[model samples]
Target: MTARAPQFCSMAWAGRPVAIEHQWIEAGPSNGPLLVFLHEGLGSVSMWRDFPSRLCERLGWQGLVYSRPGYGQSTPRPLDEPLPPDFLERQALEVLPALLQALGVDGTRRPLWLLGHSDGGSIALIHAAHHTDSVAGLVVLAPHIMVEDVSVASIAQAREAYQTTDLRERLARHHRDPDSAFWGWNDVWLSPAFRDWSIEAMLPALTCPVLAVQGQDDEYGTLQQVFGIAAAAPHTTVEVFASCGHSPHKDQTERLLDLVTTFTGASSPNHANI
Candidate 1:
């Protein structure tokens, strides 16, 4: 049978309705586990290509892929509105739970795993830390635990490329409002105060087993990001792919998938539940 198309939905958060676009694929059995894919800083559901579906198939699990507000076909940000410094926090503390509830994902009844990239990785970390019981396991790729000058410089370069080149046009294909996705992500990273941003403190609270992966040549983050996660959560496993860049799955698809499949499969239910 052909897979079902994604459904568009909206939920109220902080007294405002936020649009969410999501695709769900049921695996072999209704009793099978669930895995959620969280995209990168400027990414949306469309940008993930077939990775989610492939990974779910490999793991024998259902998949949920969604674009957060201000991305993909989701609602656009208001022109005069300025997102709070805690935008990621809002996503973790407010939006995620609401989304889960709307989708009938009972965290207590069934196992849930998060596979997040970049900014989505940070948000997943925060959520797993605070809502310890809800998450079964976490897989993070090129996650930023703290702001770095290297990341800032790369983002600045991206901003310039978007303005003077066809980068905007390319992104437009994925984002419903490309300007919102670009600026919302760009402005925050380039802001001076955002330099001090870090989630190191929250890392210690992540009790579940984590699999953190990073590319050897990732322009936005260094090995330190993975090292920090391992240090904070010693149960965490780390992998670095040679000759890879910011996006490991895109850069080294076969190897990355192999690593993820092995790690997730080896993790015991007790460790995942912790």
Candidate 2:
């Protein structure tokens, strides 16, 4: 039998229509903390595999996983337009909050934790910095604090491989509009102005306890990314894994989950992860 196409739901953000495919796994109790998983630059909800469910079950918490606009079953971007520079900012300031509100997640009533990887990691950082009072904790894996020449080079290479190799076909399994996801992200990163992009100054605004993890073998970024978070947010705890790459949740699932469980369990000014 042929595989079934994924389904998506739509919503409005700032008067513009947006689409996002999502799944919420309820664990423990209705009042339990919410752990939101943010996917990588090229990732979607389906791309997360069983990691979110496994982590939620182990941690005894609820999980919220969704594909950002232009990925998975989410809304597709216009073919003629380039993605805005504030795409990440738009997610942090508008999309996420709108999503939570739509899902009936009350920031004032329950604790919220963010688990983000790669580009998602950067978005999580921006959200935490801007909405310090709402976020309980953060788990950033391979987040980019500043643009690096190596990152730009790797992204360029990925664009080439996607066009000339099987990368596009592979990505099609995870993205509803593969071209939208590919070009939306690829074009932004490859843009000349994007080279100087950095969120270092915004890091200091983050008040919640943070756990920054990075793989030693990550091709996209280096220890500097994780260390940058530590340096900016002194309350942050850092962990480095050997033989791991940009995707720690995928590469080092067990170890990364353990660190998340431990870090989230510890009580801080923000409500502890339970």
Candidate 3:
């Protein structure tokens, strides 16, 4: 099924307010569990295609999908400006919480689940680590705990593709300003200071149940990412998909859905109150 048309909500960023593009995949019960989806570095609500809806329908739950400040139809970051090394940190520490509040998501009222991909997965880890009381569970796909040489190399290739190929045009279909989305993410991941960026230190702080998934053939990150999460957060359940690439949801959708459904179903009785 196609995702619903997106809505917008405003929040402060870098001392200035920006609009965030969001959509609600409201399925199942009226008071069912809520699963929030965090898109990848260059991803947005539209970029997620119909996966969010499919997951929600299969699980008989609801979902929220959004694009961060610079992606999709949301506010566009200045093309000339580059993101800070701590941009992902800010998204976790600041942007996400604010967006949640703005959208009236009260975890106390119902269980809150986070499903993230790539950079989004990192942000989910950071958020869950700090806001342990808020998040019910996590499903992180190809998350990064520490920078990998492979990740940097792939991102560099993406940069070249953006400049020399039709990547920009392709991305424009999903983003109002593809440059804003691509450069904001690409610049930071490739920066020298970002090479040392790692959330391994923060994983130990996670108190919620976590389902960490990685593809055996993921070009961006290795299995060590999930292994690292499992090591730090012993409560984490790790799954490695064999024929998958960076996106198991796209590459191995049915398998991923089955794993996530089982993981979330066991985490809370409210997984599907309906």
TM-score of each: 0.96, 0.94, 0.96
Q: Name model 1 segments beyond 4 Å from true.
A: 1-3, 269-274
Model 2 C-alpha RMSD to native: 3.3
Please give, for residues 1-82, the per-residue lDDT of candidate 3 as tens digits.
Answer: 4356799998887889999999988786646688899999999998898889999988888889999999999999998889
Give the alpha carbon lDDT tens digit for every residue of 1-274 in model 1.
Answer: 2135778877887678987989887663445568888899899989998888888777778888899888898887765565666788788788888999988887666777889999889888989999888788899999989998899999999999999999999999999899988898888888876878888999999977899999999999889999999999999999988999999879998898888889888884332332
lDDT for each residue of candidate 2 in 155-225, tens digit (9 for 90 to 100) = 99999999899999999998878999999999999898777889999999998889999999999997999
What C-alpha lDDT does candidate 2 achieve relative to the native structure?
A: 0.85
lDDT, candidates in the order shown: 0.85, 0.85, 0.90
**Candidate 3 wrongly placed segments (more than 4 Å):** 1-3, 269-274
In Å, residue 256's CA in model 1 sits off its true spot by 1.3
> Which scores better on TM-score, 1 or 2?
1
Q: Cα miss at 76, model 3 (Å)?
A: 0.6
**Model 2 misplaced stretches (Cα beyond 4 Å):** 1-9, 268-274
lDDT of 2 at 114: 90
